[model samples]
Each structure stands twice: as C-alpha cells, then as structure tokens.
Target: MYLTKAKDYLLLCKTIFSFLAGNSSNLISQREMERFMYLICLIFLSDADTTEDVTVVYGIEGKPISINCSYNLKENQWREKSWCKHISETKCQHVVSARRFWMPFLKRRNGTTAIADNIYEGILTVTINPLKKKDAGLYQCKTDFLGVVNTLQKVKVNVLTDLWETEAPEEPRVEQSISSTPSDTETKLHIIVAGLLGFKFLIAVLILIIARSLKNRTTEDGYRRENEHQLFPVTGNGYYS
Candidate 1:
C-alpha cells in the first residue's frame, strides 16, 4: 500500500511538471514571435526613406490630387511598376500598371488616373483628376526590378467634402453665448428666492419670541395677585387682616 501511494504521488507530480513545461514552451515561442515581428516592423520603417512610403496625399472632393512614388532601382532597371488600391487587409486590386497599357477599364473612366514614370529621375507620378468621395482609399505603389518585386510603398488618399468651407463657424459661438445667459439668470433668481425665504423665516421666529415673552409676563403677574389674595383674605371691605 505504501509503494502504491508513492507511485501515485510521483505520477501526479510528473503530470503537473509536464503541464508547466508545455506552458513555458508556449510562452517562449510567443516571446520569440513578438521579437521577430518587432524586428520586421523596424526594418520596414527603416526602408521607408528609400521606398518613399511616408507620403499621405489629401484631396478635396471635386478636385485633383497627385501621388509621387520615388524608387531606387539598381542600374536603372525598372522592369515594371504598378499602382493598386487596397481592398482588404490582405488583398489589393490593381488599378493601373505603368509598365503595361492593358488597363482599358481605368482609361474608360475618363482616364482619371494618369501614371507617368521618369526613368532618369527614378520617380513615378500618379495623378487623379476630379477626385471624388469614392476615390478615398489606401493605395500602394510597387516596383519590379529584374522580374522580382523589390520596392513597395503605400499611401493613403483622403477625400474630404467642402461643407465646412461654406458654413458659418461663428454661429456656434453665438448660440453658446445665448444658451449660457439663461443659466446665469436662473442661478441669480434661485439665490434671490432663497434669500427672501430666509428673511421671512427670521421674521416669523422674531414674532414667536415676542409673543412668548408677553405670555410669560402675564402669567407671572396673575400668579403674584393670587398669592396675595390667599395670604391676606379680604377682611370686611378693604381692611388688611
């Protein structure tokens, strides 16, 4: 019985140790993965200068906007370059390609997107005329060097309406001033009412005190007269006994 108990205790301890070991391994893996991701982000940020991914273009609705994507291709070997709009977190839709002229659909849409490449200057320019609200999205410019994807940059395009341009900004301040006057007046009125009620209460308390004093004096005088009559009963008419 003693041996069996020892074996069972050992088994329980072993199982607990195994669980702890597995948990430790998982924590280590998680830490390593986090470190790896941090390194990758650092690399991406460091390469932003070369890739020109830091530019965010803003445009107003019914206006025009241009995005400049500069690249550093070795030996001026710019094999291909493409512009795409981000559809989801992990997917993008190709809008136009500078290397090929096969995007007839984009051309049909009033040729709103015009991509120009300056091979000598290593610059790619994308212009969108008459920008609409639907043009607001995340765009990416990717370069292919020697048939391999090399440099990639992303730019976010924000299209805002001109509603604020025509509205009166001072109207809100005027309304605020008007709204605040009533509250101040109400506060003063409350204070005045409270003071009047307190004055009335003081006057009532003074009246009650004066009435109590008069009643006490009258009672004292009546008691004195009764005592005198009891001590010296009236002898025949007004003679003292």
Candidate 2:
C-alpha cells in the first residue's frame, strides 16, 4: 500500500515535469517566475497575516516554488488591489503577471524541482492552470535587471482541502450546419448568393442614375420638337399657300 502511494506521487511529479518541458518558452523569464512565486505565497498565507507559527513557517507544503512577474506601470495599480482582494481591478496585465508567478509552483508536486537551461532568461509566460492541492508550497520569484538581482515577490500556496482543481480554459464552441452536399454544389451556392446580393445592389444604383438621365433627355427632345414646329409656319392650317 505504501509503495502504491509513493508510485502515484512520482507519477504526478512526472506529469508536471513533462508539462513544463512542453512549455519551455514560458519558463524563460526568471523575473516573471520570481514574481509569480511571491504571489502564490501570498495566496497560501491568506488566512494568516504573518508567519509567526510553525504551520506558516513550514508553509502549506514542503516544496519551494518560484514564479515571475514583469514590471509594468499599467499593471502595478491593479496588483495592489489584487494583493488583498484576490480580485483584479481593471489590470488584466497584472493578473497575467500574477499567473506567471503561480505557474511553476502549481506545476510542482512532492519535493521534486524541474529545472531547465535558461528557464528564467527573458520575456516568458508562466502559468498554472487548474491548480491542485499538491501545488500549495513555498514559492519565490525574482528578476535581474542590468545585472542587479532583486526579489520582487514571494508567496506560499496552502491547500486545506483534499481535492484541488484549477481553472479550466474556456473553449469556443462552433455549431456547423448539418449538410452533406457535393463540393461543387457548396461552392456554387456560396458564389451564387454572394453574386446575387452584389448584383442586386449594383442594379438598384444604376437604375436610379439611368432613370434621371432618360428623363432629362426626354425633356430636351420635346423642347427641340416644339421649337421646330413653331419656326416652320403651317399655311392656313394644313392648306398649301
């Protein structure tokens, strides 16, 4: 029974490591990762104001995790409110920053760490989706600017419940019309509908212009005919002089 449990835990860790490897592009920026770790620590310690007790000291779990946050003036305002409320204030960018900090920690399981070459180098997005109970741990995120390293954020994730579920990605659902027509018929129908609509509009415009021109031409022709009849005098009402 103990061996089975141990094997399960190992499998979970492997799953997390594979996930990180697939998204190596996201792990490139160390600064963003550092900030994300700090954010997770804050989430874990939401119940306690300070880390005076052993529970808080040990953190929610034994593992040490890191996250990264990028510096952006527009997002800083939002981060302040998010720090307390855990709700964003029109700073989606800051929310994204926080997520970057959370990803690595959430991806971790047990005490195993997944490290890669240049995991924290430049701009990257670290994300932890569908957070699990195992994700709760000691988290840190740091960044180096101009060769000066600064710890931008630190946080610990603590999960009290046995079941941990992260947010699911929303997928766009498309309903295709049920029709199994030949390719030629489908193409013809599409082209015909488009052509008819375009031709109808063009015809309407042309008719209006042509009607106005014809009316003007008719009026001019009538005036010219009347002038000719007046100039040529009729002798005694159709009797020859």
Candidate 3:
C-alpha cells in the first residue's frame, strides 16, 4: 500500500519536474519553488518498508539497556531527533521531547532516560536505566524535518523479570568413568584390620581378668588357709568361710 503511494508521489514529482523543464522561459515563483522542494523532501523522508523494521530488544528489570537508531549521517545528523513511545505509525507519545539542536558528541540524560547522538558513527543511542515492566512496549527513534516527523527506527522492548527467562547457551557434556563396586584387595584389607583389632582387644581383656583373679585369690588365701602349711591354698567351697 505504501509502495503504491510512494510511486504515485514519485509520478507527481516527475510531472512537477517536467513542468519546470518545459517552462524554461516562464520563470517559476519563489512560493512555487518552495512548495516543490517541500514535496520532494516529504517524499524522501516518508519512504518506508512494506512491513515496519522493528528490532526486538530484551532487557532485564532494574538493568540498563541501550537501543541504537541509525540514520543518514550526511543529512540527518544536525536535524532534531526524539525518543518516543509509539502508539501508531503517525501517533507517538514523546518520552523525551525532540532536541532542537543536538550537540554532535554530548550525551544528554533526563532522569532515567539518556540520548547520545554520534554523528561520526551515524548512530543515536537511547539508554534506559533501571527499566520497569511498564517501560516494555513499542518505541520509535524519530527525526523532525521541516515540521514533518520521520521515524528512523522501530524497536520493541521486552523487560524480563527473571534472568532465566532469557535463552541461555548450552553447556558441554562431560563423560566420566566410574565403578560402583569396591576392589577385592581393599575389602580384604579392611576385614583383616577389623579382625586384628578385635583379637587384640579380646586378649587384653582376658589377661586383665586373669591377673585380677590371681591377685584376689592370693590375698584371700595367705593368712586364712586351713592348717596354714600348704604350697597350694585350698579355698573352702562348701562352707561360708
């Protein structure tokens, strides 16, 4: 639809061109010349793609992100530029009003929004700091020429609440070699250590009990043995003594 209108506008321009060329003897008025020039400028600025060239920009909530808008560096560097929230092709709410005179290299910041135009690079960068969910929507980079605003770029901003919502790069897989069973040698060593410890503990206990029993028997026997003259003491098993 736009292409057809552009073609018709171009045909009109050609007709105007023919009129100027054919009527060389008849001088054109200053107002007529200005109108012709305005029409040509309008046609040049209004040329657009069939579908809007909208670049999708993803930003994390509470983080700063910048959107770049490129334009004809030769002609548009000195023109008034704006950063706006786009409602429709012709209608937009200006986020930051158009700067009448944009200094080529300086960055201008207004609250949370910033605009930096680099004429040498032919890129206008709009930075939004600590973005909110409400800031997510369609936006435009606009340039004003002779009272007509031309959109230099269209951007769709998406502010994500979670970092995980963004697509993450895939990690490489690692291959590990592992065996679940224990080695025979290790099992045998453990068993041997356990057995030695148990054996030693049992032998020490037995020796301690025997020494205690002998000491007790000797003390009970020496002075209280029956007849008091035997190499071996006899303990009275049947009586209370």
Best by lDDT: 3
lDDT of 1 by residue, 11-80 (tens): 4444544454456643243333433443343333333323344455556578778778777746433457
Ten residues in sequence with the least summed lDDT for candidate 1: 101-110
Give a tens-digit lDDT track for model 3, residues 105-130: 57777778888877777788899998
- Clash number for each model: 0, 21, 0
Better of 2 and 3 by TM-score: 3
Better of 1 and 3 by lDDT: 3
**Candidate number with the higher TM-score (1 or 2):** 1
Question: Residue 143 lDDT in model 3?
Answer: 90
List the global CA lDDT of all models. Answer: 0.63, 0.41, 0.70
Q: Give the residue spans of candidate 1 off by over 4 A.
A: 1-54, 99-110, 145-147, 163-241
| Reference-based TM-score, model 2 | 0.24
Evaluate model 3: give its TM-score.
Answer: 0.44
Clashes of 2: 21
lDDT of 2 by residue, 1-241 (tens): 2323323543454454445545655423333333344445344344343343212222223334333334443333122111111123322112222223434322322224332112234322233433455555444444434555434344444433211211224556669855575564566577789889999999999999999999999999999989978888679779434
Q: Residue 179's C-alpha lDDT in candidate 1?
A: 47
Q: lDDT of candidate 1?
A: 0.63
Q: Report RMSD (Å) for each prediction in the order shown.
A: 24.7, 19.6, 32.7
